[model samples]
Target: MIIRREHAGDRPEILAVVKAAFPEPVEAKLLRELFASREYIPELSLVAESDRGEILGHVITTRGWIGAEKSLGLGPIAVQPEYQNQGVGSALMNATIEQANKMGESTLVLLGSTDYYPRFGFVPADSMGITSPDPSWGSHFMALPLAAHKPGLHGQFKYSEPFNAL
Candidate 1:
């Protein structure tokens, strides 16, 4: 398998992978909306491909904010159904995190499975004094301080418009 930056031509395949990974069209639609939005970080949208050139997974991180400080929002990570549980999602995540840290990003937030994201060092957003706009998420809304934790990093987290639309 190969992990690499997604290209313009990968859109269709990425959409298909996302749709296959989830049971509904919501995530797939969100992916398309995000791509057209200013929040979309082209370099941060990554894809995992098989040796045979099939896209097997996708992940994206977009502009977000923790109070007035700029942060990243990670989400909609998806793996092809056939590739699920084979490390495709993990590889995409590891690569995305490494790239984000290299870009000097200070933090990342997401709404996801606590059981899954904790392995990547994500903790409850509230633990960092960050609150999701959606109150019902509770512990499922998580945050990870990519760099050293800062005093000003706490507050309401704002995701991109595409996420807000959901």
Candidate 2:
């Protein structure tokens, strides 16, 4: 299996993988919208592929602002249904974080399962002074600093336009 950055030709396959992995259209729609916008960071969108060259999973990071601090936010990491629990998602996630770090993004935030993200070093935003618009989801929102010993980053996280529309 190969973990690599997405190329121009990978767009359709990436969307197909997301559509197949998720039940809601919101995930797929947001992907398209983000790609269309100039804000899309090509280097942060990645896919995990099989040894035979099939995309097994995908992850995307986009421009986001947390109060006065600039950051990257991860989303819609979808592994093929048959490939779930097989480490494909984890591989993609690890690669994504590394790529984001290379791009100089200090932090990565997301709205996801609390149980799942903690394994990747993500913790509640409140611990870092980050707030979500939906108070009910405060605990589910997570953040991780790319650099372990960096200065504290704190603020209210404002998701991308596509996320806000949903």
Q: Give the least accurate 10-residue stretch of model 2, judged by summed lDDT.
A: 146-155
Candidate 2 structure, TM-score to reference: 0.94
Candidate 1 lDDT over 7-89, as tens digits, reads 88999999988888899899999999999999999889999989999999999999998778888999889998877998888
User: For model 2, how does the per-residue alpha-carbon lDDT over 1-166 read when each residue is reduced to its tens digit?
Assistant: 9998898999899999999999998899999998887668888888898889999988988888887778877897999899999999899889988888777787888999987999999999888788876778978998888874255677788877788888
Off by over 4 Å in 2: 148-150
TM-score of structure candidate 1: 0.97
Once model 2 is optimally superposed onto the true structure by TM-score, how far is the C-alpha of residue 64 displaced, in angstroms?
0.3
| Winning model by TM-score | 1
lDDT of 1 at 17: 88
The local distance difference test score of each candidate is 0.90, 0.85
Clashing pairs for model 1 are none
> TM per model?
0.97, 0.94
